[model samples]
Target: MSSNTILSLVTPTISSPGVGSGLDVNGIITKLMAIESIPMRNLQKQQSGLQNEISALGQLTSSLSTFQTAMQGLTTAQLQA
Candidate 1:
């Protein structure tokens, strides 16, 4: 990229205070609560997904054990033959 493009990208714009300039402590607290809830919601989703993965892994392990038992039976039959 060019130098002018980099300068424009790095420059910060100045602006006047927003509409909530005189916002009270209660308003800030409400906003912070909303922000904090977002992470809690995301954590819940991640935990649910992890639970599903664990359940699937448990099923896979059971299936593998069953397959191994079948293989052992087959080997024994071959040895008898």
Candidate 2:
């Protein structure tokens, strides 16, 4: 292969980023996204906590309903005694 053609093949493309500005823009954006998503991560944790609380409340409600039914059955039996 010709020397000129081989050099052109190995050279960096003009369209590559940070060619002129010399700034690591992709790295900067990645760090910025991590910082920007902090609130979203916190909100996701809060949502999981709330779902756990709701599940506990549902369990409590179910237990209370079962107790009420048992109590009514006992009361009916006493009335027929």
Candidate 3:
């Protein structure tokens, strides 16, 4: 093969940023990141909501357990009377 042909294949030609590359790479990436964040934000919101629900359920269970213990004590006292 000729040196000129080898050089042509090896050398990269420089063009203006968005000229040869038709799409706006920076703008496309920015738009894609924005689109991608929507689902992430929604998932975070759902996770926070689920955490709150779990905390509330835990509190409710604790309160019910306390109430049962109190009732059992009352029953024991009544049986001894």
Candidate 4:
């Protein structure tokens, strides 16, 4: 068999007679599209996680502000007594 024939058998991108060389351009494109979408899906998950963390931080900040105000009130009352 010619080297071209062997290469076609080994690689899917080449065309061969009788046996298909597995070179399906459309299938390859579809696989690549699937691979590209994976990262985008991961980023969406990450963004959701980040939003949750931001919400938690906001709650913590509000709690800290309330605590500080309470402390200031106590200090002022002590000073007046």
Task: Report RMSD (Å) for each prediction in the order shown.
Answer: 13.8, 6.1, 5.1, 7.9
TM-score of 1: 0.53
Task: Measure candidate 1: CA RMSD.
Answer: 13.8
Please give, for residues 1-81, the per-residue lDDT of candidate 3 as tens digits.
999999999999967777667878888889999998999999999999999999999999999999988887786669788
- lDDT of candidate 1 vs native? 0.88
What TM-score quantifies how close candidate 4 is to the native fold? 0.53
> Candidate 2, residues 21-68: lDDT per residue as tens digits?
788888899999999999999999999999999999999999999998
Once fitted onto the true fold, the runs of candidate 3 whose alpha carbons sit more than 4 angstroms away are 1-28, 76-81
Locate the minimum summed-lDDT window of 10 residues in model 3: 14-23
Question: Per-prediction TM-score, please?
Answer: 0.53, 0.63, 0.58, 0.53
lDDT of 3 at 2: 100
| Model 4 per-residue lDDT tens digits across residues 1-81 | 999999879986754543565577777779999999999999999999999999999999999999988887786669788
Better of 1 and 4 by lDDT: 1
lDDT of 2 at 8: 96
- Per-residue lDDT tens digits of candidate 1, residues 1-81? 999999989999766454557747677779999998998999999999999999999999999999989887786669788
Clashing pairs in 2: none
